[model samples]
Target: MRRVSVDIGGTFTDCFLAFDGSYVEAKALTTHNNLASGFMDALGNACEQVGKDVETVLSSVDAVRYATTLGTNALIEGTGPKVAILTTAGYESTVPLMRARGYGDGLSEAEQANLPAANRPTPLVPVTRIVGIRERVDYKGEAVLGIDETDVREQIRRLVDEGAQAFVVSLINSVVNPAHEKEVERIILDEFPTHLLGSIPIILGHRVAGRKGEYARTMSAVIDALLHDQMYHGMSSLEMALRKAGYKQPMLLVHNTSGMAQMNSTTSLQTIHSGPVAGLEATNYLSKAFDQPNLIATDMGGTSFDIGLVTADGVKFYDFNPILHRWLVSTPMTYLHTLGAGGGSIARFDRMWNAVEVGPGSAGSDPGPACYGRGGTRPTTTDANLVLGYLDEENYAGGTIKLSRRRAERAIQEHICKPSGMDLIDAAKAIKRKVDHNMAQAIFKEVAVKGYNPKNFVLLSYGGGGPLHACGYSDEIGISRILIPPFSCVFSALGAGNMNQLHIHETSLYMMLYDANLRQVLSDFTEFNRTVVELEAKGREDLRRQGVPDDAIRARVEVDMRYGNQLAQTGIVVPFRRMETAADVITLLDLFSANYATRFGEGSQAPEAGVRINVIRVVSYVEHEQLRLRPSEVRVGTKPVARAQRECHFPKVDGAVSTAVYDASAVAEGMTIDGPALVESPRTTFLVDPGWRLTMGAMGSAWLEKITK
Candidate 1:
């Protein structure tokens, strides 16, 4: 059972090695020059702990799962290949215009509300590169205008003349009928054969996403085509590296869907933020193991904070129109949210309230912080944390990157204290408090908006800066329980170990279950059953192609149900795999109504307007064995080992106080260290403030519980 999992993050590449029963975790600075170098370095560190060499580890391991941020970084760095888009003739402006609300797609509510400053992201596919062909298709897959082959050929030629390296064909309602898209691909192949380097790769809109949003579906295809070459080359090189190192099995890649797939089956969009999604998967495993039915997973890193939810009822949250690197895509990706509150987030003075404001701007790794001596002068959350005495100046990042207290003070005093007319300590305290409140509000909305109570969920904190500030934020939202799981630094890698091989297939259709406007309920069970079966068969075929046995395969049926012409669709997981009886149809309607009532408020149902299933999905999978870690029994003690003592200032307490600092390795299981203490590990620091106690648990896990007054 030897396996290695790696998560390549923005700041670090985390590695987790499972050698038989023992687990070892390691981290290394990410080197963008060659991602494999950083990956190997991190893996080497873990192997050293297990008394193994690189060749021995790679050759012996059953699998090596990777969940990386490469796609995210590539998108942010604008390193993808030049792409051209082709769509229906009338929809040339779709990508540039986006949806009227696309400006707010990936923004905070506050930023979205401030419409004056709102701006759409730069178009990935420019107007000059976007060419359209004559085509028209109705929502029901009926062709209104016949295929214009001559028009398609000319449009491809024009795009090629304009230097289109890639092509996307997104005809209206292609999800329902993809004949026009198929024809366009045929013409593209015939005009420019694959043997020529000039031959462009084409992506059909329906193949990437099975939904009916014209603009979103088109953008999905465009982004996929744009990133295909980059991801393919990157993944292929990695596979070759693994092969050279004596590894044989396919290099399984983790997807944001909470599933693992081979590189051949994964899309670039599926790989974005996969590292954080792995963290969420780890949280789900923890929830089940500890019997914590509801949990909120929070990963607070240097540049972003990710939040994911797991409910007791097993209600899967999905975004039908998710934004991928600023492009709204009609794909039902697993729902996760990222907030602009992290260690590198800049903190500024709020002139209006005479308070403090945290960031939408980050001092990323390149310029870093003023303390990093990279010439960054801006005051950031890290600067505030340093000013508040939470971080050790000489021991940050294992002392690999030294911090400058003077620089931190100057940055804060000049940028925040003087502007707000407050002392440095007060200004730092305000910044911390404001950021915590911001995160708490975001978590509240994430849960409450989905008709769940924040108070009912246990907060699972991970990442470099999570535990340091978990108490500050979770307490603000009235969340009492916090679990910092074992191998918190490599939690996402742990998630990669727990994933099942899965494939999802879906198709868009305009099927009315109940036409309330005309006062009619669908009695056509054959059509309904046929659609579900077709989707299931597609999913089954995908799994079968992946080498899954028929007997081992499992499937779940889901329908995107909506009332009237509403933009929002509620996905309902149907119990019946194939609807045969009227009673089954009635049961589905009841389930949908219940889910709708829970989400958008009761009595919001508009069945009188109409009821329809816009999309049908099937998730096929062969469940694999998982890695299980036992939870430690809670023990009470008041003894602590002190490595050193430092004069630290805490916002909850007045003035500077001498706080005890201990190495995490020194803390044994069942040992407890109380208030005003710092537990320093190689990968992260746990700052235990006054009124909270830290308990060491099994498998490097720790609990930060609030002490009663």
Candidate 2:
């Protein structure tokens, strides 16, 4: 397969090219002003490695896939049109109140646990711009009160007069019955006709998400509308750039759902955190290729560290109601945990801890790390790494940007050393240790909270900065094996190339599989089967439009079940496609019970209280030819040669050690690299800490194992 996938990050743009089964990865500094320049530059680097030109590569590839942080960055920068929301009457505070926990929606656990210090995120729509529509719809799709079309038009006019650039119609129970929302859309369009007044995009809540929670669903539609213009224009520019370079196929976009779809089929909400999701996808493929399961995929980039999980049994994990930039939205995105611990994460002296603090703030590409000599004055993880002698000042990022050791020393001394009364090396050591501890704690909590043991999983580290600190954090978290997957630097981009054309359709409903009050089982399967069919049709239509045959499209069923009106919904995967008989219902109940037990505990299944299915989801996908990671015979006898020596400092390891630095490329497949050692690649560095060993594998995959006493 001839394909290309690019992941545009905060600090860099990564490109992964698959040219007739020969895979190559490349990276370029992100050009934020015009993203296409960065994309083309990264792609050009990849092309040059294989002796190909830009146009020739673009014109020949079957597809170009992108997993980008475009929407995330835009949302963070608040770069979007003014949004006006039209919610149901008496529901004006729904989005504002944020389900009473708006204060800590996207915050860390420590922040969430503090109630007095809680504060809501800045409103996406001003209270004055949010007008209520006089309409009512019950949960079961029954309209109790009629919608006022004249009233909607008047309210819309009021909001438009208030400088509303876009509109969001999110009525109560809109997912159950979208009649009121549809009417509002029609009235808005009539009032602002596209032919005369120009096209004005009006977002309807029911179309964005098929969930019942009004607040989450409303935010989903609002976010979708907010990101619509930015995502469209940005992605459109990229597509046009690709087209100019001779690419004719539709540019596929990776979704936060861990699925890839054509731009025509993507929603702005689905594009959030897509880069991290793609990295998880690549982790999944590697897990299968390398026959390793229960892996933790960790990506330590310049600005952030993202962690994702892949269970041994291949059960996909998803965040049904994930938060994006501090706003909760109803979207079933692939589950990923991101921390502000990266090379560019700012390090500071913490008065409280009397030590060091890593970030929730980053020094992005503009004035990167202080060591980059970009005029940054703050101490950062990169500066600490540089001061510790782990990084080659002259060869960082393949020498694209030269590092200033003096700048690093100055930043650390001023910000950390002087304030804490510690020496420069000591302060740098504290920074590294603190950041590693923070990451370990984050990973531990993430795994533990999900009812899994972190010790049971292998650490699959990628990204440019991951291998540098893999040993530090993994040791702290009680992990031993670290598999830096093939093309580790551009791993997320590689994951994008493996995605299939996919779509997900779902509906929120109150389904009682077993009514404890009546002591009767839900034996009749008419409604259950009908809902599944409806969802399947929607997904089928989506795939069919994308040129997939009905026979080629496959579907998976998922039901969000809970016990006794519990707010927590456990998504249970239905093994069978659809319920046909009484036996199928039993199968679903057993599946839900087992899933509940696995997540909570053996004694936590309270099916006797009641079994309710709140949501039904159907995933439709057409598989593509994946880039197979062909295995290499495990040859462990090859010896590696050292290229140079460096005096590097390791935290908790007392004195500076003279570490043998090896040319990463010189290490043949299956060669063993012993510690204390450093393997230097143009794009990244692999640190073999004391008591750990590294082995090179096929397609640039490496294994780092602990040497136990």
Q: Pick the candidate with the highest TM-score.
A: 2
Clashes of each: 0, 0
TM-score list, all predictions:
0.93, 0.98
Which regions of candidate 1 fall more than 4 Å away from where they truly are?
A: 100-104, 114-117, 350-355, 373-377, 398-407, 410-414, 417-424, 517-521, 634-638
Which one wins on lDDT? 2
User: Which tens-of-lDDT digit does each residue in 576-692 have in candidate 2?
Assistant: 876778788778888888888888889988877899888999999999999888656787767788989999999968889999999888998989977889998989999999999
Residue-wise C-alpha lDDT for candidate 1, range 1-709, written one tens digit per residue = 7889998876678898999898888887676667888888888889999998888899999789999877887877677777888888888888777767777776656787896798878778779988878888887789998778898888888887888888888888888788988988888999989998757788888888887778888887877777788788888888888888788887888988888887777888788878888889898889888778898999987778889999988887777777775667777678898878888888888788877899767785657776777788998888888888788888887677789989988998999888888998988888888888889988998888788889888888988888888988987898776888898877888889888887777887678888886777777788677877877787777667777789998988888889878988889998978877768767878898988888888898888878888888888887877888778877757576799998777767788988899998989888998878988987788888777888888887888887854
Instruction: Give Cα distance to truth, residue 430, candidate 1, Å.
Output: 3.8
Q: lDDT, candidate 1, residue 14?
A: 85
Q: What lDDT does each candidate get? A: 0.83, 0.89
The positional error of residue 83 in candidate 2, measured at the CA in angstroms, is 0.5
Local distance difference test, candidate 2: 0.89
